[model samples]
Target: MIPPAALAIHLSIGQVYAFSVFNLPLSQIIGVTVSAPADWKLTTIGWIFSIAIVFLGLSAAVFGKWLERVGPRKAMFVAALCFSGGFFVSALGVHLHQIWIVYLGYGVLGGIGLGIGYISPVSTLIKWFPDRPGMATGMAIMGFGGGAMIGSPLAVALLDYFSSPISVGVSETFLVMGAIYFSLLMFGVVTVRIPPEGWKPENFVPSSKPGKLITSNHVDADTALKTPQFWLLWVILCVNVTAGIGVLGQASPMIQEMFEGVITAEAAAGFVGLLSLFNLIGRFFWSSLSDKIGRKTVYAIYFGLGLLMYALIPSLGRLDTAILFVIGFGIIMSMYGGGFATIPAYLRDLFGTYQVGAIHGRLLTAWSTAGILGPVLVNYIREIQINAGVDKAEAYTVTMYIMAGLLLIGLVCNYLVKEVDAKHQLFKEKKREGL
Candidate 1:
């Protein structure tokens, strides 16, 4: 039941991933059928996504401690308000044809919803299933990965129902989506509950011996910032995210250009869909596996194998093997998603669950950093190579090599992670002293 509640929130907020569906329609809002002089440029519209991501990171880092203070119910309720309110505000902006209003609505207000909603259920799930933290977190986070699957189709359908001779129906679509998401999020708000103090599952005996990497002690989020392990994990997450996110943004274009005439736009879209499916499955599969194998080993596989997959994509393009190319990237995308799903449990293992949600929130700044870094690296480098006389098919070759280099750095970071120092366990002592 709690998992479903978490899913309701995650699946709704995950719609952020499918937001590209609105790009063309948004660009054509004034033109109705095509671009009009008054309509926004794609570049301008692109900033909406960037702003939302930036705010998501910022708000999460800022509000994480507050969420810990209030509990998931209140945090989720606020998330519902902000997220749904974002849609309502964006709808107004769309009707009025004001881009800045849309940015304020979806980018700022909605992103706050995203940040709070994203971390809301994570710590609760980790607490409820202490014996299997990775699997529990994976179950909920997997919904986030699969969210675009539901969101993209739903938005398109709504747009079709609402479109007309004069209207692209983006405003109408936003209104409907807002209502729907609010209802779904309220389910999470109503059902989410923290385990009673000192509660543990029946038959679950506490392990007297903690692993070297697994801490029985706690670290507050503020103090966790001062530890080396936190920064190391930050580097690991940023690099892994950077490697995958760059390719995700450019997946369709990259495949089309790599294969040229052999791959149709339709086939390229199918490729993107396939990658999304892999992303969804990998979120659950790898994280659940981590409960048995350990988080560090799973991340090691992500970076180690990721480096090989990225390095090979260029050659697959040169060899003109579309199937192998898709396979290679499918594997890469899975690891990308797996990296996200597994990290919360990794944090729990290192920092303990005392403020794991807040700590998790702080770590998402790495995602914010990667969101900007990944696209810039891929998009800018490709532009540079093209301007320097590189062929369309080969432009990504250099980019892939650079992505592989990032994975190498991530691998080193993952290997470097040992355990949090006991001195940082001062928070545990404070708890005993009733501080």
Candidate 2:
């Protein structure tokens, strides 16, 4: 059996979740390179996040079947290599002052790592913890959310020690981070394995299927895609992701500008780091809570509370960073992290574990889409402000309002989610809700 510690390690090192931490510095580096009569917009840099997500989602969709065929450990090893290697190569790009190289290493190569690593621990965790699929997936996946909390502060320190005006100090930072992540991930690879068969959690049985005839058999990705549940869930994931990412994409500038009175630009880095902490904590706390609260209800809270939080941001003054940062950024980060955790269970609920690994691959298209929408919206709105001569804080207030609207729509989607096979009430008939 895979050691639980190994499973946690496998999931923790995936860079897709933690990559947002690089947005600010990466953007600044790119901004520095722009020449006279040329400009770099916030949206331009935001593309790094979008490109990485797009590639991550795309790789997941393309590689799902292969991953299923090969197994998570082998795939995750590749993930570690690519993720770490990408960072190393990216460090080179930064040192040479080559933006395209940075994009190639960080966006393309790292994206491949992100996609593979993303689904790495999921199936193994589900197989090992059959009785508590949501909790299991959450535990493994929560690491993604937490990575930035660890990565950002660490990256900041590295940059501080190595930073130069001409060169961002991104190289040394990448070298250290790449080494650490690779070593940790290798340890996870050595320890990961599948649980023994027929090993259901004591007294565990899955809920019944709702419709056309739920069977205890596995379904392939193509067949799984035909179900309404698949498409509906695609919508659900897209909306959820869109809501959180808009805020997260611009978190640093937003906070500094929002509370400029109390919080200054220099302090903004720490506050941004703090947002990551909330992001990380929310992943573990909310995902664990979903074990008791039910995925649906937890998401309901994610959206319901999220709407209020986004609405309050612009009005929240810099009176107390402790108060505003905790309340305002906390809900936003949870939604970001929760989207990663809750969706796996949502997929299991609709598609069954038959070919869930593959179906999840397909479903990640939603992430690709959200990646574009979220960063684009943030950057586009900010671009309008920069052109109109608006300051950065004032720039994002409009985006926040738009995100609130999107969350409300996501709230509707959550509301629309009746039990998957509602008409048939398949859950009523079956005892084992196949993890």
Candidate 3:
């Protein structure tokens, strides 16, 4: 039941990842009958998603401790309101043809909902399933990936249903989606519960040694930031995300250009949807694998294997092999999702469960940074290449290599990861708190 509630919240917030479905439609929205001189450029519309992500990181960092204090129930309800309201506000922006209004609504306000909703269920889930923290966090975060699976297709279908010469159907689709998400999220708010203090699963026994890496200490969120371990993990996450998100943001166009007539626009959308499925599955598969191997080892696989796959992408594109291309990119997407799902448990191993949620919140600033860095790097480079008379098929070649380099850097950071220092450990602090 708890997992389901967490899933409900995450599934809705995950819709943000599918924002690209609107990129083409929104760009051409100003003129229903023909091209509008005032139409928004794709690059201009791209910032809306970036702004929301930036805010997602900001709100999570600023309000993470507040979420810990208030508990998931209250935090979740507020998230529901803000997230749903963003849709309505964005609809109005679409109707009026004002991009700034859309930015304010979806980017700033919707982003706040994303931050709160994302972390809301995480801490509670960890507390409920202490024996399998990796598996527990994986389940909730998997919904985020899965949400994109559902959202991308749903958005495409809705646009088809309501589209006409006079309108692209964005306004109506936003209204409908807003209402539907609010109802589903309210179900989560109603169903979620906190575990009683000292609660643990029945028949669960504490690990005898729990290893030197897994501590019996409790670090506050503030104190966690002062430690080097946190910053190392921050670098690890930032680079990992940068390697994947740019590929994801531009997946639709990249595929179309690479394969040209071999893959249609609709087929490209399905391809995006397929990647979501891989992303969703990888969150569960790799995170569960982490339980058998150590989290550090699992991340080592993500960075190392990820580096090779990224380097191979340019060659695969050059060969124009659709089947092999899909398989390769699919594996990369899995590791990308795996990186997100595994990190919370990795944090638990190093920092202990105390303030893990708040710590996780602060750590998400890496995501905000990557959110801007990834797309801008990919898109900007591709644009420069295109303007310089490079073929669209070859434009992404340099971008893929750059992404591979980012993953190599991540491998170094992961290799450097070690247990928190004793001075930073909070065993004494836990005793003071009477725990």
Candidate 4:
């Protein structure tokens, strides 16, 4: 049985990815405390997001062993509280116009919730659907990628309803969002579960070592740190993310800029809606596809195709309704979400499930790095271009070119990867070897 509890974890953890919806609102409110939106710089707002992600990765890694020891049930119960509470407190912060409080509540506390909530489902799902680990994970992680699809539109509606001319009033919006998310997460906490021990699916046995793993068997956190494969995968993830998230972080503004006079404000919001829609759909679409093609090959396609698309963005140069930008960019955004959904299976394939949840946690540091690098790079490049008097349409041209180069480098890395050898599986040999 897949377990009802697992499903809830899927829904709850998935909400973390929806934070992008708050950017404009946060920017509007935060700009007051900091300065004007244009003067405040998106990079400054991006820092709050970066802080949360850094904590998200750190908590996940530091607590991976604790989660392994205690199991997801208790951990997730606490996650519901912290995650929900973070929103409520942030609501207070926003209302008060206290940027630090917003950072503390949403960035720090909510980030902890994000990290723990994110890993909450992996081990349980792995146990329940051992035969189809990739697909099983895809189901849960697919939600994470697509969360913004539902959240974006829903938030916009709520924002539209709640919003007044009073600088997007942080407090009331916080109260509303916090209440709903709190209730929803409570439902998830009630639903999550752990698998029966020593249970394996009928007629199922994982390959002694999957052919695609970077290193065979379970590498301890210590040994995993020492391996070349770990760093290679690390670099691969960094470049991969740097290519996509830079654009995604700027997605709303980017669309607005792309559409300019051609599309109205409502239409640009709709385009952001569409990008998120594609982002959500791609999560399920690409990760599910990876099950057939193998993760490495799927990632190879992500970067290989991503490079070409990014290069073309400069030439496309703001089309009618920004449709061209939307289509091209939306596809790559899905790859970003797909990367998160697929990596757990990738870790399982190489490092073995014996300690995969832990390994996956360590791997998340790459996301933390991306959280910082992506926004900074995008915002910094924009600042430079604006200062140099480049037109809005042309401002992002060099960034597209830089992202293209990054993806091509990632393409080479993905191609270079081969399965980890048995020799590397020396630690916990009995567990991974299944003796």
Candidate 5:
């Protein structure tokens, strides 16, 4: 029930990743007159998603402690309101043909919903299933990935139904999605509950590891920030996200350009959906594996194995084997999703559960940063090369190689991660003193 509540919230908020589905129609939306130039460009429209992501990081960082204090029910309710309201407001923005309004509505408001909603259920779930933290969180986070699977196609289908010669279809879709998400999230608010303080699941024996692989101590977000471990993990997340996001942001364009006539618009949408499915599956598969192999090893595979996979993508594209290319990227997408699901457990290992939610919130700043950097890098680099007369098929090669390099940096950061210092174990000391 708890996991499902979390999933209800996550599945709705996860629709943000599918925002790219609107990129084409939104950019070419017929405004005041069919003859008038488009009010927004692809680059300008890109900021809508970027701004929302920035707010997701910001709201999570700023309000994470508040979420802890208020608990999941209230937090999820607030998130539900803001997220659904953001869409309605954005719909108005579209009706009026005002980009700034859309930015304010969806980007800022919806983003706050995203951030709050994202972390709302994390800590509670961790507490409920201490013995299976990896699998527990993985189940909920998988919904985030799965949300995109549902959202991408759902948005496309809605657009087709609502769009006509007179309508661009974006505004109506926003209105509909907003209402649906609000209802689903409200259900989460109703269903979610916090366990009694100090409660542990029955038959679960706590690990008595000698070292810091698992800790009985807790660290607040502030102290966690003061440690080197947090920053290293932040770097790992940032670069890992950068590599995956670069591909996701440009999935449609990248595929069509690489394969041209071989890959149709429908096929590109299917490819995006395929990646989302893999993303959903990898969360459960990889994070559950972490229970046996440990979190650090899981991330090592994410970065090291990820590096080699990224390197293989460009060559696959050159070979013109669509199936092989999809398979390669599928592996990459799974690791991308795995990275998100595994990190909470990793945080538990390094920081303890005292303020793990807040710490996780602060750590999400890496995601906000990557959200902007990834798309900008891929799009900007490709644009420059195209202007230089590079072939469309070859434009992404440089981007792929750059992503591989970013993964290498992530590998280095992962290697540097160690347990937090004993000095930071204030909670452990407090427990000993019976304070």
Candidate 6:
């Protein structure tokens, strides 16, 4: 029931990933079929998504402790309002042809919803399934990955239904989607529950001896910042995300450019959908696997295998093998999604469940950094290559190598992670004081 509740919120907020579907329509809002001289540039429109991501990180960090204190239900209620209201506001912006209104609505207000909704279920899910935190968090976060799968097609269908000679249908689409998402989120708010005091799964006992990296001691969110382990995990997440997000943003374009007429735009869209499917699957698969194999070991595989795949992508393009290229990227995207799902449990392991959600929220600032860094690295490097006389097909070659280098840095950071120092443990101090 809780998983379903979490899914309802995640699947709706996860629509952010499918926002590119709106880029073309929104760009042509005034022209209906093409860009008008007064219409927004694609580059300018790109900032909408960037602003939303930035705010997602900011709000998550800002509101995380509040969520922990107030509990997920109230937090989720607020998320539903902000998220749904953002859509309504953005719809008005579309209707009035006001870009700043759209930014204020979706980018700032809706992004607040995204952040709160994202972390709302994390601590609750962790508490509910203490014995298998990895699998529990994975189940809910997987919905976030799957949301784009549903959101993309749903938006396209709405646009087709509402499009007219005088309208691109974007404003109507925003209104409709807002209503739908709000209904979905309300279900989550009603269904989600926190565990009873001192609750544990039936017959599940605490481990007499925790694993070397697993802690029975708890660390508060503020103290987590002073620990090396937290920063290491932050680097690991940032690097992994930076490598994948850039490519995801460019997936449709990259496939077309790499295959050069061999793959049509329609085919490229299917490829993106396929990557989304893999992303959804990987979130569940890798994170659940982390339960058995240990979080640190699983992340090592992500960075290592990801490095190999990134290095191989350019070669696949050069070989003119679209299938192989798809396979490589599919695997990489899966690891990318897996990285997101696994990190919460990794935090639980190192910091204990005490304020883990808040810690996780603070950690997500890394994601905001990577969101800007990754796209810039990929887009700018590709442009530089092309301007320097490099062919379109090979323009991504240097970028791929650079991504592999980033993964290497991630691997080192993951290796540096160790048990949190004793001085940082809140429980240890309480015990020492005989509390």
Best by lDDT: 1
* Residue-level lDDT tens digits of model 1 in 314-335: 8899765699999899999999
Best by TM-score: 1
Global fold similarity of model 1 (TM-score): 0.98
In model 3, where do residues sit more than 4 Å from their true spots? 25-30, 383-392, 428-435
The CA lDDT of each predicted structure is 0.93, 0.71, 0.89, 0.72, 0.88, 0.92
Instruction: Kindly indicate the candidate among 2 and 5 with the higher TM-score.
Output: 5
> Which of candidates 1 and 2 reaches a greater lDDT?
1
For all candidates, the clash counts are: 0, 13, 0, 4, 0, 0
Least accurate 10 contiguous residues by lDDT in model 2: 423-432
- Angstrom error of the Cα, residue 101, model 2: value is 3.9
Off-target runs (Cα >4 Å) in candidate 4 are 1-7, 13-48, 92-98, 152-169, 172-176, 196-198, 203-216, 256-260, 318-322, 421-423, 426-435
Model 6 spans with C-alpha error above 4 angstroms: 428-435
Instruction: Rank the candidate models, highest lDDT first.
Output: 1, 6, 3, 5, 4, 2
After best superposition, candidate 5 residue 63: deviation in angstroms?
0.5
For model 3, how does the per-residue alpha-carbon lDDT over 1-435 read when each residue is reduced to its tens digit? 999999999999999988888988898787765558899888899989888888899988988899988899999998998888899999999999999999998899999999999999988988898888888889999999988777888899999999997889999999999998999899889999989866889999988878667887777788889988899899999998988989988998998899988999999988888888899999999998998788989999999999999999988886756888899999999999999999998988898776788999999999989887898899999999999999999999999999999998899988888788888777855646744
- Residue 109, candidate 3: Cα error in Å is 1.1
- All models, RMSD in angstroms: 1.2, 5.2, 2.4, 4.1, 2.5, 2.0
lDDT tens readout by residue for model 6, 1-435:
998999899999999998989999998988889999888889888888988899999999999999988999999999999998899999999899999999999999999999999999999999999899999999899999988888899999999999999999999999999999999999999999999745799999988987899998889899999999999999999999999999998999999999997999999989989999999999999999999999999999999999999999988997756999999999999999999999999999999886888999999999999999999999999999999999998999999999999999999999889999988887755644633
**The CA-based lDDT of model 5 is what?**
0.88
Q: What's the lDDT for residue 4 in model 2?
A: 55
| lDDT for each residue of candidate 2 in 1-435, tens digit (9 for 90 to 100) | 454544445444544555655655665664544432233345555665566777788888988877777887898888888888878888898677676777788788888888888887787776776667777787777677666556656777887887676655667888888898888788778778876644687777756643332234445577667666677678878877887777676766777676767667777767666666676667667777766667678878888888888787777643555476557777688677877787876666555564567778889999889877887888888898779998765777777788888878877777776544443233323424532
* Pairs of colliding residues, candidate 3: none
